[model samples]
Structures are given as structure tokens and as C-alpha cells.
Target: MPTYEFFCHRCSKPFEVTCSIAEYGRKIKAVKCTKCGSSKVVRRISAFQVQTAKKS
Candidate 1:
């Protein structure tokens, strides 16, 4: 499973959900806004950091 970030249009809030890749690929439309209980949610691009070791 992977974490996905979403933005709620009804409440103007951001949230995250962890689901299987298969479920995401299938485009399951069951995501709901935790704050406003709205189904109008959009996926957001999440930023991640990668650390590299210094060469000795």
C-alpha cells in the first residue's frame, strides 16, 4: 500500500489516505472529505525528500 494526498474542495482541507496500488489504479471513487463529508476531492502532488550519504 502507498500513501496518497488529496485536497477537499468542499472544506478546503488536505488529507492523506493509504490504499493498495490496485485500488488506486482502478480509480475507486469512494474517497470522502473528512471535514465536510463531500465526495468532491482531488488528488494532490506530494513532495518527498531523499537523503544521500557523503562520499568518504
Candidate 2:
């Protein structure tokens, strides 16, 4: 599962949704704001961290 960040335009706050890629693609139309329970939410561009193999 991936954590997707979203911002609610109505509530002016941010929230996160955890789901699989397939689930998100299929249910992309069903995302709502957690604060105000509004469907007027937009996905936020968030940074993710990646761990690489350490050099010997």
C-alpha cells in the first residue's frame, strides 16, 4: 500500500490515504476530506525517501 497525501479545498487542511495502486486507480472518484468529509479534495505532491545499498 502507498500513502497518498491530499488537501481539502473546503476544509483547508491536509490528510493522507493509504491504499493500493489498483485500488486508488479504481476508486479515485471516491476520495474525500477527512476533516470536513468533503469530496473536493486534491492530491498533494509529497516527497518520499528511498534507501539504497550502502557502499562497502
Candidate 3:
């Protein structure tokens, strides 16, 4: 699963969704503003920050 960032033009709010890449891509096209219920949504560059252990 990956985290995705979305910008809502209708409500001028930013929201995040975590799902599989395929799920994200499919649902993203139909995403709407939770506040305004508008289809004016844009996908922004989402970050997946993680800290990993170094190999010994």
C-alpha cells in the first residue's frame, strides 16, 4: 500500500489516502471533496517517508 496526497479545488483542502497503487489509481479518478462533493481533485506528489535499518 502507498500513501497518496490529493488537493480539492472545491473545498480548498488537502487530504490523504492510503491504499494500493491500483486501488488508488482507480478510485482517484472518481475522488470528490469530502466537504464539497466536487470532482475537482488533483493528485499531488505524495511522500512515503521511512527509516530503514542498515544491513549488517
TM of each candidate vs. truth = 0.66, 0.74, 0.64
State the lDDT of candidate 1 residue by residue for 1-56, as single tens digits.
Answer: 67778899988999887889878865447888778888899987654411222332
Model 1: which residue pairs collide?
none
Using TM-score as the yardstick, the better of models 2 and 3 is: 2
Error of 1 at 39 (Å): 0.9
Colliding residue pairs in candidate 3: none
CA RMSD of each candidate after superposition: 5.9, 5.3, 5.2
- Give the 10-residue window scoring lowest on summed lDDT in candidate 1: 47-56
Write the candidate numbers in order of decreasing TM-score.
Answer: 2, 1, 3
Model 3 misplaced stretches (Cα beyond 4 Å) = 47-56
Clashing pairs in model 2, backbone N/Cα/C closer than 3 A:
none
What TM-score does prediction 1 earn? Answer: 0.66
lDDT of 3 at 49: 36
As for lDDT, the candidate ahead, 1 or 3, is: 1
TM-score of 2: 0.74
lDDT per model vs. reference: 0.76, 0.81, 0.73
